[model samples]
Target: MPVHNSDIAEAFRRLADLLEIEGGNQYRVRAYRNAAATVEGLPHDAARMIEQGADLSELPGIGEDLAGKIETLIETGELPLLEEVEGRVPEGLAEITHVSGIGPKRAWKLYEELGIETIEALRKAAEAGEIRDIEGFGEKTEQNIIDALGRFEGGEKRLRLMDAEHIAEPLLDYVREIDGVKQAIIAGSYRRQKETVGDLDILVTAKRGSDVMDRFVKYDEVDEVVSKGETRSTVVLQSGFHVDLRVVAEVSYGAALFYFTGSKAHNIVVRKRAIDRGWKLNEYGLFEDNERIAGKTEEEVYEKLDLPFIPPLLRENRGEIEAAENGELPDLVQLDDIRGDLHCHTKWSDGKFTLREMAEAAKDKGYAFLGITDHSKSQTVAGGLSEDGLAKQIDEIDELNEELDGIRLLKGSEVDILENGKLDFSDNILAQLDYVICAIHGGFNLSREKQTERVLRAMDNKHFNILAHATGRLINERAPYEIDLDRIMTEAEDRGCFLELNAHPNRLDIDDARCKMARDMGLMVPIGTDAHSINGLETMRFGVAQAGRGWLEAKDVLNTRAPDELLKLMRR
Candidate 1:
């Protein structure tokens, strides 16, 4: 099996986590973490780059030593350094970090101080009243840990939707190569564009002579074949993602796709609708009196049900069926409708690229504007810019905008919203920029009332124009800090400020439901890549997918407007 970029990135990340746990040199551990981020966000496969004799070290953060490890991992599916560290570190020590409230330092402390290495041991200690005795942990923290462990226990490992796409897209491409395959699409939550996916369901239509099932189980990435039949098969891929494939006749293709691409609740509604119309709907076709009425296409299937074809992303039974019936379905935002990206970083902060390079990349993608919202000084680890440093960077953006054509660079800062609801930079400094993207960099542990007040107070700042990643979530990694988003949305509406749908795969904050809430509240939610590197701009697709699921139309997004109009809107 080919070693994917995700594999190499995971190896580097593990090495970093283990090194951090051991209190290794900060720079060395940071280098590994940085390399992991750089490799994971690459637009092309790192393994393919190595195979083409391209220099891996040319990529950002990849020094010669790290490059060699990446090459070794890709070539042999193992990293020697990682293996050596795994031997020294208790393997389960890493697993402990998966619990919500227990970071690496805490995990290491639990292991050394309490002899609690595995989650089982940690749970026992927490339950036994021993965990609260630790220097920093209290009864609250101990209970939180126990609650987190309870959540983790018996949980099925799931991948972020984009990660599933990483495996699914390539697998679908391979399946399409079968001689008789006519159509193939991976369905289920993946098709619905959920933020995370449990597994994949692939539906295919092929000619009578196809051997697609055999081809599927024989794919190079298949770790094991769970089951197989002439028309259906289940296999676990090397990445531990389970995939099921079913081939249907051309006449039944649409019905199978609709059945398998369901949120079970949504399917139930559709089936009830079919029954109301004296029709039977199943994987085979939509039938009346045992005679097929429609099945050849999804459009036909919905047409028979007296509804227009619903986009897969909006088929969550969340008022979509009702909306379709009432002719109130939204025209969800599209990738092409995006006119600019308003939140991104550069080497001025923690980004890998320079201002001009980022501008050029956005321009290449047909964007009219790109906002340089690099981190402000409170985010020390990202090397946030001081006020003086931000002034100089703003001047550079001014120069770049003049020299560049077809794209405008907006001067901005991702200023931290401090604990007391103060902006990181002075109002005078913040007002000089095109806009301000205030965010929470620290103090994620505030009370629900305090957190909401902090954000609302920040929004009240005269310079505040957008809230970057409003929820501060890292998907499965960290839960959103306790804040009343309903209150935040109301405040944003009153204040004329917008919210961001941070497009980074790991931080698709202001989730689909919130996005829908923003739309209903008449808030302008722009999709920003928050790109640290040029390649990060490609993450816009995920954000667009997320927005579609949220039922956002082009008009609901601020950046969908032309540059001039967007500037005016942001100022509102």
Candidate 2:
């Protein structure tokens, strides 16, 4: 019996293979693949859809012949064609084909000649000479298999966001072509803009899937096309991310997307909680032992779980689960809730925009004020401003404030916290401005204990009002230096220092989990776009989404306060 989530698709795929193995008509073999996608995408269980008399012919490729076969599967418990296919094709071939570099032709050759089946067996054979002996197999193929094994090394592994996107776009585009497709989107970490993404999961809604299976295989971008079915299909993007496109009816699109775009841990916690109350949770709709309960969209998914629908950015094994279960998810934060930006560079140091241009951009963004934090004297690589440069920038800012219509600009520095717990700019240089956002630009080799201490001491500098990019993590480029987030959050909170939620997509640092924890600790969180240019200001929306994931409300944000109020907090 098919048991996996992707089973229905797998079943039809097998039928297609059996057609070839039995030397059946090519069109006849294609029917099984077509029917599989239709079955997979009905928005309800395939067995249930069949029992309710939903016509498989609604799918484009499925006609009387294949529809009858699918009806038999639900009614009789077996397919004559499936049995023949199983007999002729080795059971292990489907899984073997799942590996990145392997295909049915290679899988067939391995099974027929070398008797290779499971991924492990194939790995072993490839490592040895079993695969090399195949007609087309060579060292290159062997190396590719080895690389594939490494790619799939960890359980439910993760990938870079760029890698995940490369796979998702093509599949999402194809999903819209399914007979019933009405809307489509990519959800989960990929949507959340997480740096390291797992497999690409897409959300889709369709009205007719009878034609779905046939259309998916026809997508121009799909490569090494392995299997096609009525409701769904697994295709390898040229980029090597395995995308499984799911088809569901328009009514259930929202719920299905919620289920598929999950942090598995988040879903498990919600599902178990539902089961505790005699409700079943799944992609289609929440059920009370097979009775329709709630589900039409993502909101329903959370409502059924007895919590508000959380956004994609907030689903990572963060505190959202606990917050939701407790009926205490923070009030949703909106993009407009942010009133000021605390981390920005000006051409006075590393930024491209002049002080007036930066202030004008902030006004355009409707911000009450903007913090112009240029590099301090120590970071000369950024053309760091020396004392005289700081004085000149301050004079320029004061003149701009006098002449400018609205947005007020504050002079500050992204000052380096030197190795020995000292700031790059002196008190004279710091006090001449409105605020300071001290940061760690280097010295990552210090012990976690010393690094934490160095930052805490910097926080004590009365002139330094914000801790910018606290972890100094740069997504795929840099690892978060070994500092204790718990300790860092505590110190920042105790001292009333603003914690930066850097909005650089590469550094959504102090991510939602830490962000939630910071909220729990009653720490002040400032959502900063850390814009290097005008285009970067848009990144604040991502930070707002992240804040929502942490269950933070407008009141919970530091910059949400009026400029006068914010200044009071920074001064204190």
Candidate 3:
């Protein structure tokens, strides 16, 4: 029943969507959306902060009014404003807005014109060719909606890794505390650090007569107990996320973990290797002529298969088994390998923290340096710096650098790559910065060729150091903008430019596959947190996990180098 940051963020997002559909003020709607982002990015639970007597208003984008509302939500399990807005907006209208190519305003227009408030109603209208008659919505828009609906309906609902973490970690802690439980760990895709997970698989080791299953089914957050047994149980949490728990004896613990924590394809290939050796392998143990040989640990199982232990992140059957056999498996990047974050923001832009605070936070995290890449002039909504403003910031950074110790702040701008492939700032202004991080802030619907050309042209500039986000994706909320990433990687390699693995949970852009592509193309991938606040810096671990999954080693990441070396590498 604890109110997590994700829950608060979801409430704010729902309220914003409903208010937008109800024709609310633009700034007010934006405030809620930004608040949702801030809340979602927070590393700690808002309810726990309040419990510890911390002021919620101190959080970025959270004002006195928003903080009071958060308190109401945490204390009363409801947000009064959200409840009020939900009453004013047609419930289905908010859902309709979730469809791609449809915004709240479009949803409202659809409702006003055709009385279409539900997705099914909209689908009926689109299929019948009635939607194309709407003034602004033409045949193309109608067809796009039908296609979008097909995808929307067919796709399974899965939680983003971070949201699932917020739910699963607490449940994990609960299970680990059970009296007779000796071990508890989340397995499957969560173990492999995938961006999104369908369900949680928990494996536990417990003593005989342990009541682990009984206690797991009675957990506070469980909405329903789907099935329960002595060794295994399945439950659904209040958020509609499902979990399965299995209890195993200590002897078979590792084998159970190995089987359950699987990319099924990886397991299949390994099992085939065992079969070729005239042995059988499964959840309980590896067998030779019905005599148990090895299964006491995952290492034992791997050793018996004549393979080195494969990291969970590389268990996607993506050449990892072959690499392990040949001893060519990468050492893989770890969270500790990161020395600094190359992309973050300050109060100079839309970020909540000042330069000094962010630098100190970086120092606190043991980073040797932190890049302060505030927004360029084009992102006015994010308080993007004007030419004069950027000049002032560059000067301020020089002065702060002189006063600061232990950590260096690299001067930079997240310069927008304009639709026509022009940098937002002139080269003269860009020359003043230590480095540049170019990104696309708009024009997500550009054709693939145009998008690729835009990025390529931007990289042609000498000041371009890193391609931020690379693909402008927002996990489940938005698809990656169309572009030939292989060509982009090739161009980046040729141009001495790097691609970013933006670590922000919502925008783990340039996803795992692209990261691997960059690696194979000999491109250095910098894992930038795109941090807007101090707490936002904690997302670095998620980025590292993603990089590991992509087979990146320490040498493959840009920020893994020392301050001087990283700066040298950034120099074109």
- Lowest lDDT sum, 10 consecutive residues, model 1, at 148-157
Error of 1 at 146 (Å): 5.5
- Residues 63-151, candidate 3: write the lDDT tens digits: 89999988888777899888888787888887788777898889999999999988789889999999898999999899878776764
Best lDDT among the predictions, by candidate number: 3
- Tell me the TM-score of each prediction against the true structure: 0.96, 0.67, 0.95
Candidate that beats the other on lDDT, 1 or 3, i.e. the better one = 3
Residue 477: error of model 2 in Å? Answer: 1.7
Q: Is candidate 2 or candidate 3 better by lDDT?
A: 3
Model 1, range 1-572, lDDT digits (tens) per residue? Answer: 77887787778888888888887888998898899889878877887788788998888788798898888888789888889999988877877876777888999999989888787898899999999989999999998787666556334557877677778888999999998999998889998988888888999988887889889999999999999998889999999888999999899999999999998889999999999989899999999989999998989999889899999999888899999999999998999999989889999989998999999999999999998999999899999999999999988988888899999998888999999999999988987898888899777667789999999888878889998888777766666777898888888989899889998888888899999999888898989988889889999999999999999999998889887788788785
Q: Give the runs in model 2 whose Cα sits over 4 Å from its true position.
A: 1-180, 191-195, 209-223, 301-326
**Pairwise TM-score winner, candidates 1 and 2:** 1
- Give a tens-digit lDDT track for model 2, residues 1-572: 21211244556777776556445677666566545544432333555456677776655456777777666765555668678768767776766665655656777777778878777787788778656667887877777677666544323435544334434554676677666667778766677666666556555665542566667667655666677766667777544556666667666776677787787887888888789998888888888887867767878767776787776766766677776678766677788788878778777875656788888889998989988888888988567999899999899889888998878887777889988888988898889887788888876646689989898888778887788888877554345665776877887777777778887665777777777787777887888877766655766766777777676788888888777888887785
Kindly indicate the candidate among 2 and 3 with the higher TM-score: 3
Candidate lDDT scores, in order, read 0.88, 0.71, 0.89
